[model samples]
Target: MTNTKKETRTVNIDIRKDLFGANENAAALNAETFKKHGIVAIDIMGSVGTGKTQLIETLCDHLRDKYRILMLAGDLATTIDADRVASHGVDTVQINTGTACHLDARMVRVALQNVNLADYQVIFIENVGNLICPAGYSLGVDRKLVVVSITEGPYMIRKHPLTIKHADMVIINKIDLVEALEFDIDALEADIREVDAAIPVLRVSSKTGEGIDQLIKVLNL
Candidate 1:
């Protein structure tokens, strides 16, 4: 008779807690940073030339009386955007990312030092005009507005689900160009609905100031 020995195997277990809970954690930290200064942070995201900067200009023109406005412009490289937005008579800080595609938590912290968030009720972080990369980063904004212009075509909302998924509001800009480009508003809204059913979508023409009042109301101004 052969004696069989039972073998016991021990698995090593290691527990390492995450310092932050993914994207929301970063967003929360950003929220805290803005709260500390009593500033309302607005993160603007969109595709290139989607009238994003222009939208900010419009917002400033309308909301300037109600809130002190400041801006942080993010680009791959160049102060051109900052310069453009600053022309609106608001303090603007530019973040040249160089190789990076998006503005992260650390970038927001750095930009805060340049401008006094306490002086302004609102601080707008115009994220690198990108639909893809900006979705993954948190800038500590009270609201995230994803702008999709009619010039970019109706398919943008459907194509960039991630951007829509994280957006607190969606602005469909360039409605004035809709007639010229034969853009379909219904289809675009439907596409946005596909990605996010309950998101607030404001159709606006920064060029013509159409639907700007709706935006103002949405912003509570």
Candidate 2:
């Protein structure tokens, strides 16, 4: 018993769209709100255990007087990161995303209400520690900085292309662990160059205070 069916012709359709226009519009409004307040919001993206909070705290030490900084720390639960960062004498807002993966612009816009954005020169959103979902959404930020560690491996740049692609600056944190971890620093630098030729890579040891100054200079510029 052979059941044969006639071949059907296929039609090509050219359709372009953003499925969630509300999100896009809200992101635009979020940017407008940040600009109105003169806040340079930067979203920090990285994998889990990349030392994002520590690097940001270290940055606060140099940038405190230069700019009034506020941190919006996102996580699955708790205000622990926000609490820790606020101990450095800057305002911090914690957004518990529950089961969600990333922080979008609307989340940022809502969080801004807790603090006075006008008084701050920069707002840093320590996005949930995921390399993929965070890179797709804009948080009304002026810059997207990706943080990585030597301990993570020299090949992290290649594995997480979205973060590397969108990153304006990449912080290679935990340089103090390079020798102990047998990390290939030059190879890591080359990997970053291959992923993004224009983006700057910085090797910083928050514990020992190495290359921190250069980072500040880049931020100021």
Stretch of 10 with least lDDT, candidate 1: 13-22
**Candidate No. with top TM-score:** 2
Q: How well does each candidate superpose onto the true structure, as a TM-score?
A: 0.87, 0.88
In the range 1-221, model 2's lDDT, one tens digit per residue, is 99999999997654323524555787789889888888788889888879889988888887888788888999999998999899999889999999979887788878876676678888888999888888777776788888888877767777878788877999989999988998898888888898888888999997777999998888762
Give Cα distance to truth, residue 211, candidate 2, Å: 1.1
Residue 130's lDDT within candidate 2 is 88
Clash totals, every prediction? 0, 0
Question: Which segments of model 2 are wrong by more than 4 Å?
Answer: 1-21
lDDT of 1 by residue, 1-221 (tens): 99999999997644322322454566677789778878878899999999888989888888777888888999999898889878888889998989878888777777776665568888888999888988867667889999998888667777779999988999999998887898889999998998889999999999889999989889765
Question: How far does residue 201 in candidate 2 sit from its true spot (Å)?
Answer: 1.0
Q: Sum up the clashes in candidate 2.
A: 0
Q: What's the CA RMSD of model 2 in angstroms?
A: 5.6
